[model samples]
Target: MRCDGGKPACQQCVRAKKSDGCEYDDGKGKTRTQIMREHIARLESRIKELESPEITTPPITLFDPHAASPYFSESSSSSSHDSPGTTISLSASASPAPFPIGATADLESAHWDGQWSSMHDFPAVPQIGEPFGAEDPPLELAQMLLEIFLPHRHQCGLELHVGRLRESLTHPLSEQRHPVLMNAIYLWACFLSRPGQLYEHEGLYLSRALAAVNDAIANPAKAVDFIQASCLLSVYFLSNGRLLEGSYHASAAASLALQWGLHQIGRDDFVGSMSSERESTFRLEPAKDSIEQGERILAFWQVFNLDRCWSVALQRPATIPDSKHPWTAITTPWPQRMEDYETGEVDIGPGSPTIHAFFIHQAQVSNAIGGFSTFALHAKAAALLEGASRLSSSWSPQLSTSPSLTDNFRAFEHTITRFTTSLLPLHQLSATMPEDKYSLILIHSLAHASMIRLHEPFLDDQVSRDVALRAARSVTVVAKHIADGDFDYLDPLIGHCWVCAARVLISELAQLQTTWPPANTVDIRGELSTLLFSMNKLSSRFPLLAYQATKVQKLLDAN
Candidate 1:
């Protein structure tokens, strides 16, 4: 219709200038033109911020401007952007642009390489007042924090681009900086830090993060950082017993994920134009289009994982409803390492597998595990336990009176049994695949935990009591060893496992001679002591575990 000043290209030779870009007769300001203009304005602001010398202040110049600035290399004034002596600032070391418009640099860090550093090397995080502005934490401290969080990043659903993160923090502006996400990251770092480091700054970081998260939730179209920030905050809150708040943030992330079209593989609703080249124009930095795309995929998966896990953990319905979305039809591939995405090593072709493939079938029935080689069985097992937990949480006095629950438990029991039995043999899981051993530990322990969850409700039956108690003791011994060994950090699901195990042990102890029948009163007090001690070990880091431990202690004291 461009032939006669129209959009549909009508079959007529008319001298209608298409250069003005085909405005329709229906609307003027309410079109893609306006959306594109908004994007352009954001891009322009980003460019101006990077170019302007007075935009951010320097704390301790990490790198020379000539070497660091991606654009012009001229040295800018060193004066603080804020009122003199009132604020601190930082700058990105890799230059204003860390990548070419559509791609990232070769991100080579020791993290993904063969060599690994001990996470204990981070500087102690001292207490700070309300962290209101860009008083950037030291560059060394930031790198150390990044390192400390790396071992547990996969479990935490953190998928930030290391190269870009490093550059952005090196020169952080007040608004340009993703302070909320930064605070959340630091909160985790502080949590994992040496004993007292956590208590000192956790509140400060959390206060700032929560405030920003609230703003982002109110206006989700703000930026990609909000999604990741919300995901991290949700995890932090849940791990520390902030259930209601955590669920709110997690649900908010889910809403934003859908609104931003993060669920689809090639979604362009946010991008006004169809061209990748045109879309790249909105980018704030040079990190590739793939980096942004990968972030969206990873971020959405993070939210999805949270929805499933917490729905079970908290005994609530999931925000990401499986019945409504094309979740099964999602073709998005599993997330590669951030380094791989940054360096353009993303293998999304026939060779690479989709993350959703992990849920298609149970264990050996489908080759999704091997199909997605980077897949962690602990994460998979956690998801299955969540499913079982969801079923267990359905126990109402009315529902409990019905016989249908037995059939449901039986079906789920068979599924979990098959999954546990199908695991790789010990000989197969070697030093090379160290993660496999931990995965096996978690899967096996949680599988036993699943049996308890499914059967404990019907404990009046001798068979159900035996099954639940057997699984309870099994997980206790196995989980204690896992907590003390190979895995650097156990996810919060593991704490829930401990909670269930403690309940069974405490309930059995309550019955004493009647339950034992004066025949098998073997020294069970020692076992109870061991379980309580193990729970104590984790309580310092996870307050929910502390709460569970306290409940158990009170029970034992009462008896």
Candidate 2:
């Protein structure tokens, strides 16, 4: 019943359609709507100044020499040689900028602990013509933000090929560089660059992204970019603990994907009838090349991953339908890496019953598709977790006795066990990149969390408790690894898995308190501490994680 403190309107007010009543006392005595209106008014006045021929004053430069550069590029240091108010552009073929090389702080480095406040002191955004949305950002700023965003792209279901996107950046009006996607990327760049001046532009870029999204709805030609933008916006909201906004955008993305027949890519059979009316109107052809085709496939799966995993985390029904309805059945093959798309190594063949292949074909073998890469494994893990959560939620003492329900539950347990056991060792699976390692950790941890959820309701049964405990311990080990690493980015959903793991540990700790000398008390407490530490670290970026950490701490206090 508590407000999530979302901007413009809290989740409760949004749900009740009473956003007018949502107000915060920041000592300013203004509703969020009022504040937004005032900000819009100022921007509108600024817009008129840019448009008026009578106003010929030159724009002021807002750059600060002492602060981190507004632009990030390999040649950024060269910028100090330029005169004030000079404009710079980077070619897409320019050497890629090293991560956090010129920025004030890396995403997860020591500076993140407290130094980010200086980001506010850097400089105000140059307001001349609102460069971000009105015109494309300078190529250098665009490429820099893209680089900062790419590593964490998976966190928001982005499926664009890095090589292709970078290539498209050189072209001002490339479809790959659509306004919705660009604005969304700029918003994230601002968000992730917490110790740089770009962070100050988060609100500006977010508004532009939202505005572009609305414009995109009427332009079916930009449907793919719209879906990608929606996914990015969803994660932005979710990371800030705004579930209603997150879920709304998430559902929108999935709905658009389905509407465009992304789930049935390469399937000439079902495509004709899937959206006959819309097809006749727009006649949007399938992707023109393998790269575009691969994007469609990856986009569908990204939405699938988001819809499935997040629904479980939110304890809500999933947005994307598969197998439940003929019209919405997913026929897209499992996705390959962006590199595969660029090289034309993608599989464009029609999909077999997609989720079935993972649970049945892949689960039964240890070397299925060469042991499945981390990305593919992540999709499978999400499917298993969603399946377990959905099935378990519908269970009750009476339903548990139903043969069909019991059989389904046992089947999920079996599939998850075999699926997890078949996975390659974490060390072998992960690449040298920290982002790769973080992703590997998340999928494996999520798989274990699935087992925990499947057995959670049956904890009174000794067998169920044993299974759940082992899985919880596995998740705790992953949490420890995550806590010890210097990861610059982490998927916010990982915090939810940690919360589930913490609950099992809390139960064990409670039982241990009943006995003299409390067997394994130190070990349980250590694992619990590790989970809490990881959650708290993550909470620094995501408010929902802070809430979860607080609830767990209170449970520990009560114990």
**If scored against the real structure, what TM-score would every candidate get?**
0.63, 0.73
lDDT of 2 by residue, 462-554 (tens): 898889999999998777666443334678888878888888989988988899876768888888999889887876655557656766776
Q: Give candidate 2's whole-model lDDT.
A: 0.67
Window of ten residues with lowest summed lDDT in model 1: 90-99
lDDT of 1 by residue, 1-559 (tens): 3224344422332233222334334443344346544654454344234334365554334333223322211322232221123322211111111112221121122221111132222222333443223334545555555555655665576665666666776663533436567777876766665353333456555654654554454443344688888888888766655566678788888777765655544323322244354433233332247676667656766776677666666666767543323332333444454545666655442321233344445333333322233333444565567767777667765643557876777777877777666766434443223343555665666777777877767676778787888878877667555535454455665666666776777667666656535635354556667667766676656655655565566666665
lDDT of each: 0.55, 0.67
Model 1, residue 511: distance off in Å is: 4.6
Off by over 4 Å in 2: 1-135, 174-176, 269-283, 362-371, 398-400, 427-433, 483-486
**lDDT for position 181 in model 2:** 81
Superposition error at 155 for model 2 (Å): 3.5
